[model samples]
Target: MNVRSQIKDYIAAQPEPKQKDLQELHGLILGIMPDCKLWFLDGKDESGRVVSNPNIGYGVQVIKYADGKNKDFYQIGMSANTTGISIYIMGIKDKKYLAEKFGKKIGQASVTGYCIKFRTLKNIDVGVLEDAMRYGIEQTRV
Candidate 1:
């Protein structure tokens, strides 16, 4: 259906605890960027195979490729995995910036180039995650 409906359905389809966490993250992201554009990716390729988990996205960021192509994508995204959840913060230049700045501070989460993954909300610091998300969103404006 719609983006919001798709997002809710995605979250609702998750198993226990994960479903709760996904719902919380969905609300948190909306609270941070209430006016942002919402998005939903079913994690399917051209063949429609499930290559990855479904993602709920927020905000808009234009991605410029070296081949002189550009596309609009979400500035931030959240997804539920088999083990836990993943939050993707796009538009960062430095690959190590997120890990260096927020890796340790975010608790038991894994901070990669543009992703912060954790088992649950209690395993990580929500404030630090918010800071990273805010940074990602601000970076897109520059």
Candidate 2:
């Protein structure tokens, strides 16, 4: 049905401890961006094929603006990979700016115009991360 329900169902199917970790992670993310509405992308590989493996992870989405203008003005999403968890700011351009500000404090950064990857949640400064999320949400500009 809804994206939140889809994510919850997906997580619910997992085994105990992994499911618990995912629930905690979900709570942490929701707490950080309380206004964001959830969406799912069902990510594809670099080849643009929908990944069939659950272990490859799924995409988390947030509709950044709701002026009833653009359909998907901005999307903030994340994916957990073998390397680390990634925070995607769909159309914002503050990755390098943010990384420069917190790279040393967090960890090494891999950046593009609007995508950032940190090896672990522990590596990021949650306050700064929250600010980044706000920036992403604002970038949609309704």
Candidate 3:
């Protein structure tokens, strides 16, 4: 199916409050980047074993590997995990920036190099999250 359809199916398959949160986040991200490209990754390998949670991605960023190959990828990604949800802001250079800048301000979320993880949306400050995402988008823009 198409990326939007896949994203809908993935979000619909999530359990309980997480489903609601995912929907809200989907809309929120869209509001942030209204014309961004959508992406969905089933998180599987060639063997089809479940490797990671399915991802709903937004925007585009080109990744350059050490082997000199380049690939297009999402600038921001979201997924439901066992304990919570993970929001990945993929193009930041400083590993400590998120944690140092938004960690304390983002409520209960864990701010890592390029990810903001939290148990639920209500437990975190959504505005700071938005700021981080905006920063990521700006940083990734070519």
TM-score between model 1 and native: 0.96
Question: Top model by lDDT, which number?
Answer: 3
Alpha carbon deviation, residue 106, candidate 1 (Å): 0.7
Q: Which ten residues in a row have the lowest lDDT in candidate 2?
A: 53-62
In Å, residue 132's CA in model 1 sits off its true spot by 0.8
**How well is each residue in 11-117 modelled by candidate 3, as lDDT tens digits?**
99999899999999999999999999999999998899988888989999998899999999999999999998999999899999989999999999988899999
TM-score of each: 0.96, 0.61, 0.96
* TM-score, cand. 2 vs. native: 0.61
RMSD of 3: 0.9
Candidate 2, pairs of clashing residues: none
Give residue 40's error in model 2 in angstroms.
Answer: 0.6
RMSD of 1: 1.0
**Candidate ranking (lDDT, best to worst):** 3, 1, 2
Model 1, range 17-87, lDDT digits (tens) per residue?
Answer: 99998888888889999999999999999999989888988999899999999999999999988789999
Model 3 alpha-carbon drift over 4 Å, by segment: none
Residue range with the least summed lDDT across 10 consecutive positions in model 3: 45-54
